[model samples]
Target: MIEQSLQGRRAFILQNTTLEPPPHTPELALHVASEITPIWKMTEEALEEIGLPPPFWAFAWAGGQALARYTLDNPQIVTGHGVVDFASGSGIVAIAAKKAGAARVLAADIDPFCEAATELNAQANGVEVDFTAENLLDAPPPAWASVILAGDICYEKPLAERVMAWLGQARAAGATVLIGDPGRSYFPRQGLTKLAEYQVPTTRELEDMEVKKTAVWKLP
Candidate 1:
């Protein structure tokens, strides 16, 4: 029997989808779905000029194509590592890490909808992940061997600052931190090392970013 989250809630691993609507239960679908196109429409020039999008709505934001590509290519990086998918939207990165053979995986996000989405998605992918709706700045799980953040902390200033601070603490505690982003305004450019780059789909020329430029960075 395939395990699933409790009724009334579950995470979903969106396939061929650049994003997932928030709350995972469809009740909040209006908010989540509404943000998808607008977020995609965000251009590098726009981000550079506007700084960050106002956090007006809640959505289970998967980093989309870039993150998906990274997981597909570097499955080995997560093999045997205890992993945490910070800001896990639709649980894509967590699912990818699980596919990569991470010994354990946890999908953490502040949005309740994201928690449901992560759990459902992980189950759909035949992967088991611990899902939680909690703020990272408050208190992070103690046992995460590695932290994998994809495309979230770079979108807003306060969120980026908080996640970065948490990341620094996690790094100091000897946890490996990896970040995948497609050039958001708040991505820290100072201490991170580039691991790889991929062409992920974007809403630009392709039907759904058949390919867009994205990069992976690691904090040592």
Candidate 2:
């Protein structure tokens, strides 16, 4: 995949977004696009022209917020363990894992912009998180990941099915797999145990309502 340089992407993010604490998790600050309309309203052709995908990294999604909250509250789940945050987006969950005393944290995403965003967000939160633009879904889940966390990943049907199967493999390989979902259309509820529930505040532009009832589920 053709990718922009980290410096260029970082500049673009700083110019477009403001460092603000997400509504649900105020303890951590993220570089979020304050004016959501301009980014969200951009046409597909325009995005292609700009060589960018949907700016999922520009928002603190509800699923991510819920997962971060759950991690911070239940530190034992991550403390001293190597954790991986798949489809890391703004790296909120990864930062939360580090803050909760994780031994190491990796933020994996295919979005080229996510490497820069995750790096900046980790710095903003005073946490160190390694990031990879490599699409982790293309291969087997890392066996070293003692815990795997994913949020807001089940958006499209095909991708949801693929990710679920990959995560299931990770579970069978002895990794603790946790998913944070805000009722996405393709998210599978079966074969998962509810760990926590949260009412997360989000923008109406992203969801049907201003507040989303989100939940954290653990793979059994």
Candidate 3:
């Protein structure tokens, strides 16, 4: 489990020891680094340092842990490939892709703060990744990446449908789309292949229930 020094909370990591939960800075996890596993707490000082504006919710969802764990164990999938983490909650998936030998990695999210968190965590993890705050669906496809990674995006139907549509377009353009979800209801079952399955642990924030197991999946 990783111990989050910022929040003083500990969580189990996929491949190794638990990581200290990241500081509860909006720019760190809620915005920038979507790949780092969440520890479920944060300090107000850390939040202030990141310039988080008032009237913001403190809690967040991080799906990149499961994706990162899978990538770390399946290096062949990302080795020397160009990768992108779409809807990157904390850039966790992109960071994992880089660790797994991707030639280049990009963490993309709609929230500007998420980009900041991605950068912070990338630096903390001793890696480099391209971070973007734009909504990819509104912008043209990034021609640089050949692989797309998504995690926990199926929780919401409208968003999930939009992302899946984009992934289909990306796939049609020759890019591989891989998604890691915990069996959300909106997850599209057809036109995708289950590359792997993992019993990912989850908390109440996103699940809206007690802790439970989540499944990881990949595309054809």
Highest lDDT against the true fold, candidate? 2
Worst 10 residues of 3 by lDDT: 9-18
Taking all chains together, each candidate's TM-score versus the true structure is 0.69, 0.94, 0.71
Q: What ordering of candidates by lDDT runs from best to worst? A: 2, 3, 1
Backbone clash count, each prediction separately? 13, 0, 32
User: How accurate locally is residue 156 in candidate 2, as Cα lDDT from 0 to 100?
Assistant: 96
CA shift at 116, candidate 2, in angstroms?
0.7
Top-TM-score candidate index: 2
Tens-place lDDT per residue, model 2, 1-220, is 1234788778877877899999989999999986566854442233356545567888999999999999999999999999999999999999999999999999999977788899999999899999888888888999889899999999999999999999999999999999999999999998799999999999887889999999999999
Positional deviation of 130 in candidate 2, in angstroms?
0.5
The local distance difference test score of each candidate is: 0.59, 0.90, 0.62
Deviation in Å, model 1, residue 44 alpha carbon: 28
What TM-score should be assigned to candidate 2? 0.94
Off by over 4 Å in 2: 1-3, 40-52
